[model samples]
Target chain A: MNMVVCVKQVIDPEAPPASFKINQSDNTVVPPSGIPPVLSPFDENAIEAALQIKDAQGGKITAVSLGINLLRDVVKKPLSMGADDLILLEDEAFVNGDSLSTAYALAMAIKKIGEYDIIFCGRQAADWDAGQVGSGIAEILGLPCVTLAKKIDITNGKARIERVTADGYEVIEVSLPALITVSNEFGEPRYPTIKGIMAAKRKQPIVWKAADIESESSKLGATGRRTKLLKLFQPVREGECEIIEGESPEEAAVNLALKLREAKVI
Target chain B: MADYKGVMVYGESTDGKLAAITTELLGCGRKLADDLGQELYAVILGSDINGLAQEAIAFGADKVFTVDDPLLKDYQSDSYTPVMEKVVKEVMPEIILLGQTSLGRDLAPRLAFRLDTAVSMDCIDLSIDPESKLMLQTRSVYGGNAQATFTSESSPQIATVRAKTMSSMERDDSRKGEIITIEAGLDPSAIRTKVLEKVIEEVEGIKIEDAEVVVAGGRGIGSEEGFKQLGELAKILNGAVGASRPPCDNGWISDSSQVGLTGKIVSPNVYIAVAVSGASQHMSGCSGSKNIIAINRDPDANIFKASHYGVVGDWKKILPAFTSKVKELLDK
Candidate 1:
């Protein structure tokens, strides 16, 4: 079995509030100081999902990423974690692409990669939280797609998965050649070992440009994007917080409950 | 130019009852439809759900489209997508709104992809641009650090809004609307995915999302034993127990009890965050809570900034005292 996993580099979602800066002109986030870019946390889970399948099924896993600059550290992180190969869809035109255009470029890359049994993607990117690219890719490739799978196992040309639902979870089974978006409930991703890191240094990722992927320039970037970002701003918080004061923890707790009761919230 | 007419909202139902988010979507859809001078239509797919269709109309839908089939009872992307695609083709609504629940998150993107459109997920607010007549969808990004407004250039603007963010319209049984029964034409053989079984994690007490007050614990809770104190406090207050990501990830609590960007976004009237450091991810989920009371030993904890009330102390000491105080108050 062969598999492909889509990974993206995003500003760490857990970064401190003060670290982020907004560029009003473009309505995009500026990379924070002292905080380096990391692979989207869920994408790391995607790599782990693929690695687990390869470990059990005896197959090669290819990690695909689309972005500009394509940091060396971020690009190799998947390979270091046990992906067999890496494909970088790098071009100036790919920078401002929205979910649909990004999916279009990735579907093209997968078609070029040719042989594959399944594809894996993070449930959603921590940055934009769009959660659309995986299904979009599946639609473009004309394959069935499942989102938010907490556990997945492939057997007899079919993949059985436990997908997350609102109240609980449901067991599902889909045939091979499908796309699955993994959720964090799948479990913690394994950290790369020293030997794996050394091996990653020797395996260089194949770089592809817009022309190499044969995508139209007009349909590959900001021009091709179906959605337009109007503005990026923080919502102004309303109401002043009144602190309940007391000399001791017990007294404070008493005063707090009284305040909630006074407010009719209790 | 495309002549897209009505505003369509996908009405989601569970156990023969309409989901709260469906009414919330209709509330927003009613406003957008009124602004666009288009009718508001609610599309429900399920078996024996005519009652839900009437409820949709009572909650501000001008028209309801019902597709009742046994295959539609369970929500599978492969089974529902074709039927939805067929409905959209026939109805041709200009704006499509859905709740960002599990089903919506799974279905909206697939439908958008099939229709060759784009989707804005987990939006907090929706409005219509008077000039362009396009739907402006606003959603929090980067774990609630900022909100971005998105507008799609495609024919049908698709969006999924977070639950509890928008108000649901009051149900008025006196209100009358049209109900159109549509043929699903679903082929059971075409369904690729099969449902093996559903495992519902049973949680006692009011669900964390629907609770009026939520008592949430974080890494500062120390151990599973600490959660017991939280449960005690919640029980005294007639509320529910929630947790930050660490406790849930560490197996100290169930994943369903998690309150954060990745877990459940809640907006209880009062939220008591115990031993929680208030990471932005966790804060985003509960920021909508009316009153937040943070109890942590560290005075500089970020949670304090987002809290309405702060009690700087050890949770081990604070929780027991808090529970006793609440119990005493309730006893009176």
Candidate 2:
């Protein structure tokens, strides 16, 4: 079996909110100082999903990413975690591409890579939270897709998955050569060991440019983007909090309930 | 300029009844359609779901499209995608809206990709640009640290709105609308994915997402027993219990009760967050609540920043007092 996992490098979502700054002029987020970029939490889950598959069925995993000025250190996290190889699609034009174009570029790269039985992606990117690219890639490749899979297992040449739903969960089975978007429910990702990190340093990723992937120049980046960012801003929260005054915890609780009743919220 | 016209909404149903999120989509869709001076249309796909078409009209849709098929009764993307693609080609609606539920999240991207368009997922707000006639979609990003507005350059602007952000419109049975039954030509054999089983967990009380008031706990609650106290307070207020991701991940609570970006997004009348340090990820789920009251031992807990009222204390003692006080008020 062969698997392809897609990963992304993003600003640390767990960083203190005050540290994040936005560039209102370009409608983009500015990475905070001191905090280095890290692999998206969901993408780590995707890699873990791939590793689990490899552990059971014995397969080679290739982790892929598309970005400009590609953070080599950050993109290599998957390789450190256990991916056999890494493929980076880096170009100046790849900057700020929308979900459609990004998926297009990825599909093209996958086609160039040739043989693969399954593809894995994070349920959604932490930055935009679009959650479209995985299915978008499946569409471009003309393959079946299952989103938000919490568990996956290969059985009788078919992939059985447990998908998360609003109320509970559902079990679905699909043929191979399919794509799945792994959700957080999959489980915590494994931490890279010292030996794995040492081995990763020797495994340099193969980098490809826009022209190398045989993608049409017209459909590469901003030119192929179907959505335009209109504006970006922080939502304003008004009104000062009225801290309930009390000498003790019990007193505060009583005062708080009284205030809620007066406000007609209960 | 593209000659695109009406606004279309995907009316979703669960267990033979129209989902509340579908009604919410219609409410927002009605405003967008009216602002664009076009028709408000709804597309329903399920076996024996003709009744939903009428409900769609009462909620605000001017025309409802029905594709009743047994294959579509269960949402297989392969079966529904071709049918929706055919409807989009025939209707040529300028804007397509859906609720950002599990179904919509699975289908919208596939449809958008097939149509060569773009989609904005989990939008909290939508408005039409009078000058360009483009749908401006506002969605949370960076774990709810910021909101970004986007417009599709393509013909059909596709978007999925988060539930509870928009209220469902008042239903008017007197209103009438057109119900068109279209042939989906669905071939069940073509679908590669097969559903093995669906287990709907039996919940004991009101769902946390639908509750008018939510009493939530976090890691500070200490243990599963701590959540029991929170549940008692919720019961007294006629509300529901919720939790942050930590408690859920720790197995103190079920994932269904977890309120965060990865969990359920809820907007209740009042959200009482106890023992929860307000992470942006957790706040994003319930920030839309009308009022927030936080109780934490640490006075500088991040949750205080987003709260309308704050109490510095331990939840163990405070919750009991709060529950009694709430019980007293209700007795009056």
Candidate 3:
């Protein structure tokens, strides 16, 4: 069996405030730089979900990715962590496209590579937090797709999937050739090993483009997008902070509570 | 002006069952669709999913897009996106909506991308412009320290709304709607990522994200034991419990319990905040809540600004009153 897990690079969420740059013209965050990059925390969950499937079914797991940073370093993390193959969707055109473009690029590359039993994608991208790539890829390929999956099981050669619903859970059974969006609860991501890291340093990453996957240009870029940013301005902050002055913990607590009741927060 | 066909809500599903967010979205979507003089259309996709389509209409949809294909038995990203994309192209829906649950977070953006539409995530409120019927999407940005309202001029103006942010309407069994069938053209070789296995993690089960009511703790909880009181309150409410960053960082609660930009974003119907000092990161997570009751010792706690009700007193005293009130209401 074969499985492919998708991973993307994200800025360390805990980085110092100064690490990020904002383009004054727009409220959009300038992609963080000089900050250490790691596998998206959610992608780690996706990879972990894939690893569990590979471990149980005994298959070669391939890690597919798209980005502009050091491809080798990013590719090596998965290789070291246990992925059998790594494909990098590296190219300028694939980089800036929103969720649809990113997903198309990934699907295009995955199609070029060959056949696989299943594919896994993070529930959402941390930086953009748009969470659309997996479904976008599913749309492009016209396959069965499930999102927000909390658990996945394969029995008697069919996939038994459970996803979170509003009140409880929605359970479904699916066959092979499906796309799944992994939840943060899918599994705890694994860390790389010393030996795996050493071996990963020597592995190679295959790169692909939007053209490689067979998509039209108009549908691949900005034209394909229907949403427009009418205004991107920093949010206006109103109402200054109010201070409740008091002495003694009990008095302070009481004073706070009194004020809270007045504020209707109690 | 082209015919304002009204708005559409992408009622989400899993397996053959409907998700809570889907119902909630339909209820809210119904209001918007009605106001716009357009019929509410709820879309559900998955194999054998039509059995669950009735709930959409019960909540308020005028019509449903039902696709039951063997190929759609399981969720595949590549296969489903195209089906939805194709349907939207044919329907030319004015506004498309989804719940900001895990599924919505994943699929809405992809649908937006496929349709080349713009999307606003984690919206707390939705309203239709009386004049244009353009969706007025309200959401908290910059970690919930602030809130913004927007409108989409783009086709299929898309927005992923948060669950529990709006009260779900009572189900009307007498309501009626039509179910339209859809065919997803798919094949074996088309799906690249195959499912060899799926392993559900052993994390603490459904949390605030899925809870109807949530009791949240903040810094003023002081210590781990401070949050212990929340457990009693949560149990009584039959709701989940959550905390701010300080408590989690202080190890008062598990990291999973933290609510902020770094943690899970939740929007329950009733959010009870205790001893929390609301920072932007922490506020963002809780802001989506529908009915907020702030309970803090501090009069100036950031939570009070947006809370619907205020209790300015020791949680030790205020919580007991609140819980007892709920118990009384339940007994009646």
Each model's lDDT comes to 0.88, 0.90, 0.70
- Give the per-residue lDDT of model 3 (tens digit) for A60-89: 888888876644775568888888888876
Highest DockQ model number: 2
How large is the i-RMS for each model, in angstroms? 1.6, 1.5, 7.1
Off by over 4 Å in 2: B324-332
Ranking by lDDT: 2, 1, 3
Q: Write the per-residue lDDT of candidate 1 for residues B1-332, one digit (tens) a residue.
A: 27788999999986677888889999999999999888999999988886998999899999999899999878898988899999999999999999898889989999998888889999999999999888999998888888999899897899999988888888899999999999999888888888899999978999988898899999988788888889988888789999998898788888889898778889998899998988877887899898898898888787888888878887786677777777877898
Query: Model 1, range A149-218, lDDT digits (tens) per residue?
Result: 8898889999999998767899999998999999988889999999989999999899998889867777
lDDT score of residue A215 within candidate 2: 83
Each candidate's root-mean-square deviation in Å? 1.6, 1.7, 7.0
Return the TM-scores of chain A for each candidate in numbered order: 0.96, 0.96, 0.86
DockQ of 2: 0.75
By TM-score rank, best first, the candidates go 1, 2, 3
Per-residue CA lDDT of candidate 2, range B1-332, in tens?
A: 36778999999986677899999999999999999889999999888886899999999999999998888868888988999999998889999998899999999999998988889999999999889878999999888889999999887899999988887889999989999989988777779999899978655698887899899999999889999989888888779999998787677877778898878998899999999989888998998889999999988787888999988888888989989998999999
Q: What is the lDDT of residue A263 in candidate 1?
A: 74
